[model samples]
Target: MSNKYEEIAQAAIKLFEQKGYHATSVQDIADEVGLQKGSLYHYISSKEELLMKITQQSISGFNRRLEKIIETQVSAKDRLILAIQNHVVSVAANLEMTTVLLREALSLEPEHHTVIKNETDRYLSLWAQIIDEGVKAGEFKPGNSRLIALAILGSCNWVYRWYQEGGKLTPEEIGSYFAHIFIDGIKK
Candidate 1:
């Protein structure tokens, strides 16, 4: 992405994360980026348009990572653990952006919402496929792989809401703990 685009996106994400999407105005983002609101419009047609771009850009990067992780010549269980770890770290690193996605993405215009939803569904499918492979290989327990995938992923997404940057657990610690809980169960 262009530096201008990155600057605009970072500003927008921070604003959206802090003040929320509806509360944050184009002017706020422009001020954050040191651009005139009119000039900001030159780069983005509208605030909603910018939101869509940010959502898509953030997710597409993660999707690329997921694609690579899934393609690794590793056991399905190993891939799932790795995917969980990466998901946790990525969400923690981009907490604000991820929060915007979790909280503000649904408020997009219908077409934009559909685009984001489809991308999300595709990502969920990847998780399901990994779980399915594990089940088939007699690695993970057999049940609803899709539901299990959702539970695992939903837990990760919820992290943005409660995560403190310097809190008790680091991202890797949280990721590993979550993976262990999902893969091995909480019963001791």
Candidate 2:
């Protein structure tokens, strides 16, 4: 990404996280990035466009990472856990981007929303397929693979809200815990 685009995205994330998408304006991001209002337009067309770009960029990064993970020939269980680890670790590594993705991504234009949603659906479907394979192999219990996949994704995605660096649970530790919960339900 160009430095200008990065600057604008970072500023928008901070503003969006603090004041939210509806309240933030292009001038606000421009002020945050030390650029004039007109100069901001040169880098981005509109505040919504900037929001979409930021969201799309984050989603694309995640898709790329997950694609690499899917290509690995690990066991289904191991692959699921690895996916959790990569998601958590990558979120931790890119905190602002992750926050933009989870918290502010929904406020984009309809077309942009569809693009991200489609990519997300594909990612979820891959996880569901892995879980289905595990169930067939007797490694996972019989259940709704799609719902289970959604639960795992939701559980992992929500961590960015409370997770902190150098906290009691590291990303790997958190990833393992999540994997345990997914593989074995909370029943005794």
Candidate 3:
């Protein structure tokens, strides 16, 4: 994407996070990016298109990261730690996009929603695969891998709600803390 397109997407994410998708209009996004509403259409077809782009980009980036971690030859326990840390750090770094995704993703049209859902399911499956590997290797107690994956992702995703830049913990520190909690909870 061009720098201007990136600027527009960032502006849309900020507005969507602050005022919400339903409440935020194309005009609001255009004003945020210092462009006329008509000119904004040159970059995006509609407000929902912008929302879908932001949501897809954030989830796809994390999915790619998780896929790499899953493929590593490390122990499942180590992979899980890395996965948790990656998630927490990603959520913290993209809080505005994360918040917009959590709040407005369902607002997408049905076809768009389905695409996002499939991408999300792939992400969840990667987490479950790590847990399953750990259980099979006697590194973690036997349990529903899918459920455990959801629990870990839920905890990490919620960091966007309270994360502050220059808060008590840096993103990496918070990620490490979450990794420790999950590792201890699941370790055999």
Best by TM-score: 3
**Tens digit per residue, CA lDDT, model 1, 40-80:** 88788899988999899878877888999999999888898
Model 1 segments beyond 4 Å from truth?
Answer: 186-188
Prediction 1 global C-alpha lDDT: 0.89
How well is each residue in 1-188 modelled by candidate 2, as lDDT tens digits?
68988878889988987888889988889899999999888889898887788778888888888888778888778888888888888888878777877887788878888988898888788888878877877777888889988888888888888888899988989988888777666111
Poorest 10 consecutive residues of model 1 by lDDT?
179-188
RMSD of each: 1.9, 2.3, 1.0
Predicted candidate 3 versus true structure: per-residue lDDT over 104-182, tens digit per residue: 8999999999999999999999999999999999999999899999999989988988899999899889989988998
Every model's TM-score: 0.95, 0.90, 0.96
Tell me the lDDT of candidate 3: 0.92
Pick out the ten consecutive residues of candidate 3 with the lowest summed lDDT.
Answer: 94-103
Angstrom error at residue 45, model 3 = 0.7
* Per-residue lDDT of 41 in model 1: 81
Error of 3 at 92 (Å): 0.8
Which wins on TM-score, candidate 1 or candidate 2?
Answer: 1
Pairs that collide, model 1: none
The pairs that clash in candidate 2 are none
